[model samples]
Target chain A: MNGTPEGTPERTVRVVIVDDHAIFRSGLKADLDARIDVVGEAGTVDQAIAVIAEARPEVVLLDVHLPGGLGGGGREVISGSATLLGSTSFLALSVSDAAEDVVAVIRAGARGYVTKTISGAEISDAVMRVADGDAVFSPRLAGFVLDAFGTAPADIADDELDRLSARELEVMRLIARGYSYKEVAKELFISIKTVETHVSAVLRKLQLSSRHELTKWAAERRLL
Target chain B: MTTALQRPPLVRSSDRMIAGVCAGLADHLGWPVKYVRLGMVLASFAGGAGVAFYAWLWTMVPTADESARRNARRPASPIAPAVSLPAPVVREAPRGPLPLGPLPDGGAPPFAVPAPAVAAWFRTRRIQYGKEILLGAGLLLVAAILIARQFGVDVPLGTLIPAAAILGGAAIAWMQLDETRRAGLVDKTKADQAGGWVRLAAGLALVVAGVLVMVSGSGSWEQTWLALLASVAVLGGVALVLLPWGLKFWKDLETERAGRVRETERAEIAAHLHDSVLQTLALIQRRAGSEQDVVRLARAQERELRIWLYRDAAKDAGLLADRIKAAAAEVEDTHGHAVDVVTVGDAAMTERHEALVQAAREAMLNAARHGGGTVSVYLESSDAGSEIFIKDRGPGFDPDAVPEDRLGVRESIIGRMKRHGGTAVIASSPDGTEVRLGLKAADTAEARIGEEKP
Candidate 1:
């Protein structure tokens, strides 16, 4: 979005698509090939695999739980081909992001995963993310990953928090670590009243009753 | 402590070692610990039956100390926390004088649950899923290769690689009928055993069908006795077997989830022991540590593990809230959150239905994520009807969000939903978002309920 214009003529994103529905594949390819970057397309995993292995496209766009059947050999193709997921990069374009399908493909190490109903730009962006070595996952998938991982009750608001001034949290940590007002003031080269004010505000916001309890809660939350 | 109060028996654990209730009695009375143990073991041996007594003691007595709650976050002592590794335990310095409960009168409890059990389950799940995908893909590849050759599209794998590819795709898809065994992975409330039986039955049928097709070479199994035999034993037994045994995997998940249940979380102490101090102890046990050190460390870990488990118990009490969320989604058009409201009656289950469900879910998710809207859905209550609506308030652009991105108003909203006898409505406003779904439901009451509910 920065250097690239809205239609910046950069290297076209090469893509190989697969779907069991031939007409569906044709329609999809027409959309992609029309964009000046679609290298090849196939209607089944085999054709996609062969095309991907041969053409080595920048992105191997996939459709989950394809129209065809699945079992031992079908699973093997997905897993074996999974090696290319993080490298040559496989992007799942699926209709179902059911926890089973989403988690299954993710554990196999897909570079990017989105449903087929996604917009062309999102699909294009997924391809770009895969091309750029960044992992891409739909929003629903983000929750799936967190659920599957069973993340301990930790703050998952990292991106939002990153934008805020770290200085504020740091000041709160110093107070929680038992540095009294004057001491905190001395450490930060600020007035004792400023330290007192900050401590007062921190306690109020975190909703702790006293300084002692504040430190305890902060310690347990690893906020200190 | 008096003998009666001191000598509570061990709860159900393993055999061989008693809860040492007798030992507690001896220690309290300033007598040899072995005397009490021998008396009980002998008591059982004489007539009560030693093993039965052992089991009973395991059931009756607080294994370590019924009151000595191990922390759910860690192991018994400061001993090995991780399970795979062996680390020595160490006696921890007491925090302060305390009454009993999580705190020990003499010392913290000295027990730890093995760790590998929990981690290994997820790891096993991952491996199994990989196996399934690899198998599925391989089948497709072989078929696609055969089809290519059959159609003379090239790739000389012999006759009909092209036709075989098409059939293989069918065979591969037909094979997925077995993976249905994985449905309850996220939901614990489902009566899984019954489902497991059904899944096993279904899987076996699928496997038999697959094998019959592979080996029987296009024979009508209904007309042939050999096909029937193969279907029942080879295909049915094998596919059915994975479901029953795979049931352990399901139970393990339940055990993990129980940490969130009040009744079940009484056992969360075990997992806490595993995750924290147990994990730490496992690390310490292998390294050189004195017996006294291991004992002390184990005591510390037990307390820590106890604190963690109690805290986890508190947190797990609300785990039902998640299921509540899932249920709510079923009635509403929630995109970011999960909700599925579908009427799956045999003949009605068609490719179009699947495509519609998939498309709606995808678009709704996108609108919620990018278009900046709250996803709300209502399945129209009519004959086999469903109505879904997704609305967003983001800058309602004239053009679609993306081209290859697919879930545009076309493929995602109209095309797929339309196939399922459903309609997808995408309407965005400057104020906010909304999508209305009109779907055919066998029981309009179900769809009407979604609409009428708050």
Candidate 2:
């Protein structure tokens, strides 16, 4: 993929790695492909917010448990930069697979969640996916997001599910059930790029984290 | 016969049904207590003399306190009588003192009293019983005077009765005035410490009797003044006896208070050790790397110490699951294998729970050592019992092919569950291996019953 076609110049994905462990950040930075640029790094919530704001990276890899900033952890970094949320997306890279950790980061507006054990290539691909406005998740963590938000809508407030447009709801259920952007697009008889726009709108309406969490949310509610 | 000179026989206060008088007499005379008691009861039918004699013995016999004091003073004596007497003698020696040969007196009695020993014994007994004898004589004299008056003989009842009262009170006061004697009496009847009212009443009775005597006396005022002085002397002696007892009681209270404070401080130190030392050990167990085996050994020690410390804390099932997860994590870290632990339901960590955990841990180790990449542990519990499953995706082995000497499977896992009234089932094919350990509540009850029967 890095061997771009004969004439066009390659565009690198601008990324910021935020993690508490220095060794993990450095190792990840070293392992990432040349097509991805690690523009900045931060170990704490405040530092992450500051670096993300200053670097204006297209993708921020966040750790769920960071040292500072109102004790909000990774969620603080996301909420602290609300204005940047429109232009900059987040992909959470954490060592924890705990259901609450996954749900918290997702609800705080991370576009995906993956464990530290994932290979560097997978992490790079995940970064590109999040930068392209697509949700990514490690296969195991998808179940947690589904279980948390996928409960029957009868138990949820009517307005919570009712706020979505019919088309957005269809997109949500499909995306939440572990469907990729291309798969959701084919299923809905829509263009692949249009599917991304609908997913972004569905995520905004439902206040969810990523497509993996969306699959969990839809599966838990038995919507798919 | 034991000589009184060796060590005066003391009333066994702890062995007493009522003042230990019979037991003491039996001890001194080397007679069975039942026989001595029977003799006293039979003698009591002869004009009530036995009751008075028993009371006299109760009053004069040196109590345990006096015996201890005597023992303390004569350290050179081989037999410290009080120290030699076993505290549990009353329970063990219910048959009473050993019987000797027939007595020379008349009937073939249970005890034989040597002639010289009896004479020497009486000689010493007379001195101890002297005040009681005097009081008895004084009572007889007053009775004789009253009888004389009843028969119309000219006898001054008031003067004679008051004189008897004064003599009896003086005798009691004289016997109890010595500090050692007072301590002996106080220790024997601990109730006397609260008997101030009784003492006051006795003093008031003596003064009333003396006042009557003074009113009826034909003698001069000097004789009446002498009787009043005697009454005052009796009251003063009673006060002297009570003073030392009160001091001893106060000192004992102070000692007890100090002991309680020291106990509280020790308990506080124990609580501190529980929190700090155990917590540090737990942290080391989690963080230690290449020292994983040492950490596990320390963790086991910590668990035992915790069990000993908080013995009454109920072991929750959640904690059992947590322990299993921790064990799996250790194996994962040490061997570079991935283990996923999942738990369902909650219960108390009973013996069955512990057995399941141990078996599961063994299974996990087996999987990590011989099986594929990722191992999964599942723990589920219900009201019936708990179940644990350890699965690995490694190439499976035939159960029959296992070496006879390999105790990891045979003893650690299978034998453990069997002992706990549980079952361990292992399934291995070329694809993977899975071990399931199951414990049932009914089986636990049966195992307990089986244990009790044997």
Find the candidate with the highest lDDT and give its number: 2
Give Cα distance to truth, residue B23, candidate 2, Å.
Answer: 22
lDDT of 1 by residue, B124-180 (tens): 445433432343345335444545656887664333333343443454344344333
Give each model's clash number: 138, 7
Which docking band does candidate 1 fall into?
A: incorrect
On the 0 to 100 scale, the lDDT of residue B369 in model 2 is 92
User: How well does chain B match by TM-score in each candidate?
Assistant: 0.24, 0.35
Number of the top-ranking candidate, with DockQ as the measure: 2
Candidate 1 chain B least-lDDT 10 residues: B81-90
What is the model-wide C-alpha lDDT for candidate 1?
Answer: 0.45
* Tens digits of per-residue lDDT for model 2, A53-165: 99999999999989988998998899998899989999887765455566677778988777776567668777777877776644334334223434233333445542455
- Model 1 Cα interface RMS deviation (Å): 19.7
What's the C-alpha lDDT at position B408 in model 1? Answer: 64
Q: Write the per-residue lDDT of candidate 1 for residues A1-224, one digit (tens) a residue.
A: 00111234465777777666777777666554233377777765566667777777777777666544354222334665665654566666666524455444543545546666444554665576556654554444433332332223224463321121244344433332223234446668987556444433422332222224323433443321
Model 2 has an lDDT value of 0.63
